[model samples]
Target: MSTAPHLEAGGLLLIADESLSPALVEQAAPVLAQGGLALCQGPGSPSGPRRLVLFDGKLTPTHAEALRGEPPALLLATRASDGRPSTWEARLLGDLLRGAPLLPAGASRHRLQSVADISAAGGAAARAVTQAGGSRTAAALVADVVHELAANAMWDAPVDSRGQHRYAHRRSEVREVAPEDACELAYAVEEGRMWLEVVDRFGGLRPGPFARALGGWG
Candidate 1:
């Protein structure tokens, strides 16, 4: 997302060359509709619920032609700003392709109902990871993600009836989240994979603003 250009059109999530024709998406519908992801290659984005993947981030014309359907693509991002894809990106794509459930059902879960709980969750993550035979580095990473997602859920996701952020500005101050405003964090560690999930009760956040965040009814 930081470097690769992405587009949301025709219910497709396009991730390809800026030079690629918009017509490429014209033929594709929402491939993610079926809840299963398709890894399409070459042009003609999957007409159904499938996602197109490009091997090269610096897509040449042929690569561009690979664009067809936008099925929640997860490109390998070869040569992103650096010579290789970011570790998280590579790991994420690897995880999805490996077919493991993004959030396993047996994961340990935690809740954050107050700002104080955010820091506590991070500590719990590190301890849990270590107990599960994970390295401190791995533990640190998951803990950080947990911290962030908790913050976003509590502060970034809330919107009031007037469509204003309920507590975004007060993010700097410590406070308790009302029971209804609480967020959940869950994690699971498999032999080779680690998964983290954060659930905010409010789907109140939008892409950029309160109106769009509130959806069409806003």
Candidate 2:
């Protein structure tokens, strides 16, 4: 079993957006409650003061109207460009939690070997932070962001082609895999910036908008 880094406590406050499925909402509720994080619950109407507001898909006019009264401490909206399951929802949540405040994703760090290892790579990275005594405030953010972008490269990149699969994660850099199906991933911390790079020899495919969006989270 993998041991995640130690997680600091600020408490996660999850505001379920209207777009979230009942199942996901249910799952998050217990997790936050267990962690002692406050869960914001009220009428769906957006009118009111709130720390943060999360929505399932694009905020509809009604949703927006409700929010007009409450500017939300932060706004998170999900959208599916590739029609992948929960990918968009995950992206929105990651973005709001990270407070990235930027558009257009970052550049690639390295080429990855086989798409199968994206989850493993991300999981490893998140585990490293948690085990290293990082903040759980963004633990899920780091994990999901890395998992989605890295996983996208594996499934979307050409089976024979190889391009650098790079990503920026919490206070670390990662570079993994190149020639062999089993490449290396590197993570380092510098000047309070985390870097993650993945190197793969196969070079020829381009990432799609959906994958690109996920990568741009930072």
Which has the greatest lDDT? 1
Q: Candidate 1, overall lDDT?
A: 0.58
Would you list the C-alpha lDDT of every candidate in the order shown? 0.58, 0.43
Model 1 agreement with the true structure over 90-166: per-residue lDDT tens digits: 44544565576567568888888887788888888788889888898988988888888889998878777787887
Q: Write the per-residue lDDT of candidate 2 for residues 52-73, one digit (tens) a residue.
A: 4445555344343333333323
Per-prediction TM-score to the true structure, in the order listed: 0.57, 0.31
Please provide the root mean square deviation of candidate 1 (C-alpha atoms, Å): 9.5
Off by over 4 Å in 2: 1-116, 160-184, 205-218
